[model samples]
Target: MSSASLKTIQSHSTRTTPMPRYTMLAVLPCLLFASVVPAQADEHTQPMLKRLAGVWEVEEGMNQGEEIPEKELEGTIMKIEKNMIVTYDREQREVYRALFTLDETKKPVHIDMTTEMKGMPPMKSFGIIKMEEGDEFEICYALPGADRPKEFKSPKGSKVMLFEAERED
Candidate 1:
């Protein structure tokens, strides 16, 4: 073709049209939202969370090899909803709430719980959990700032606590 026509074609081919600012603004939020939504949805859909979600009554508990008194255990309840765990006392008063994460790939299912209490700094505890038959489960965890427990036991002066719970009907 003519040189002028060829140059015009080349220039047009090399040109890049800028996306409109308003379109980018709108698309950026959607992109951010899309990126976030899947992670949140995936967290809720985790198989472990599905199995753990429910109300549970604390059947037995031990701390530092000392058993918690039966009276203290009475009327205590735990509720796992999504990734949150809420515990209530004998009077049904909220005791503490924690956000938890599970690593099911680990042999004994690793758990990390972060609790925030009013007037206190956030505390993170590491633990291992075992799901048993007949809707019973056990958890053994170290206190905040301590190493994760290697087993489901709270030996004397171990700074670990173990709890056995049964799912409520």
Candidate 2:
């Protein structure tokens, strides 16, 4: 198998490349080493995660048929303190926080979100997620008024827009 397919951490925008999963798994350790070192004394892991700590612009793609102007960030570094991986995006006063963690296999990350509004109900949601390579990933939010979670895709799928560090920059 190739590392491309298995590597859950997304990298540059895929160029129609049939990125093999096993390829990514093989490539990850090296890239992870270059990027993720867990030793507190090691200055990489926290910073790399921090690189994930920022705002991102969603370029609506094939799956997402609409566009929105603004979005922001919400979450804590302690989010990763335990086994949970929490995150969010903000727009003006409204905030959306997503809490999740790598699955038992630690490949496709599982995520959940809470949309906060002043006079409306908070939308609680979940998604089977992976890092949107190159600062982009999608999620299918579980709508409060709905039964099954609907399918969503795009740079911002459903209401779950994971703001990541833009790779181009």
Candidate 3:
């Protein structure tokens, strides 16, 4: 995605009743990354995509160097299926919908997600993903209009969001 597209996504007005901070920070990246697993994934990516297709619960996350308290992440859920990702808040209300593409050829697995939140313009984001042992995985992504993050850290001054999730299904 081009920088201009990212800028357009970031330029939209904020919602009047904003989503909870943790909901937005912790679940958005996962939603975006998970949405990209196409059903027709190539041979090289099929195994990884198969592993990612399921229901997940956010276990922990950090955004722009601030930790997302566990209390805030409670009840957040992400469901992934064949290139589509849907995210729900604690109340079980859908908060985001996105489509994603994955490039497993990259060392850490590159992902590009295009998300459309209610009443907002679609936003495109880039990030890296790592699948860990036994149904655990992590994703680190940049905010709309920011450069893709090179590492998994979301340190101070970085526009990155990092999340670790575990399969719930």
Candidate 4:
């Protein structure tokens, strides 16, 4: 074979062989970046939960289009812990315990709460939570057997509950 022809063939082979390494180099950074993005988002939301670690009282609540009287809620206290929320009744009896997860990547932020009652079966509820201007926060959640709420507002529905709470401590 002529020297020029041999050199041309060698160059063509070299060009095709390096494609795999080039592709691997391109993909490595994306893989690394993908892994870190979720972790950083989780870390950012950790602080948001921390801010909720305190005592709160519900200023307003609606269940199935009926307004819950303030007197009925006055006895209820919501305590938010690291990964759990506990509700106490007027008699200081533990009424509810739920483990919750937050997804801040959503536009309005999404929440999943798994509640385990004393005599009832475990229930999972989907909700959207938002922090207001002050130390108040709101939650509009779908009851069991319902779908996730798209907006923070709950209309006249039988399976939706909305609570407006303020941090007492």
Error of 1 at 131 (Å): 0.7
Using lDDT as the measure, which candidate wins?
1
Clashes of each: 0, 18, 1, 0
TM-score of each: 0.71, 0.37, 0.71, 0.69
Q: Between candidates 1 and 3, which one is better according to lDDT?
A: 1
lDDT per residue for candidate 2 within 1-169, as digits (tens), equals 5777645444554555656879989998899797766546633333334433444433332323344333312221212323233333333332334333333243344445455455767666555443454455444434444332334443434433322223223
- lDDT: which is higher, 3 or 4? 3
Encode model 1's per-residue lDDT on 22-50: one tens digit a residue. 99998999999888775555432457778
| Poorly placed runs, candidate 2 (over 4 Å) | 1-51, 61-107, 145-169
Q: Over the stretch 1-169, how does candidate 4's per-residue lDDT look in tens digits? A: 8989976877888646544658999999999988877544443345668777898887888886678889888867789988798988778789888899988888687889999787888899988888876688888889977988887666775688888989888
Model 3, residue pairs in steric clash: 36-100
- The C-alpha stretches of model 1 lying farther than 4 A from their native spots are 1-46
What lDDT is obtained when candidate 4 is compared to the true structure? 0.82
Candidate 4 off by > 4 Å: 1-46
Prediction RMSDs, each to the true structure: 11.4, 19.1, 26.4, 10.2
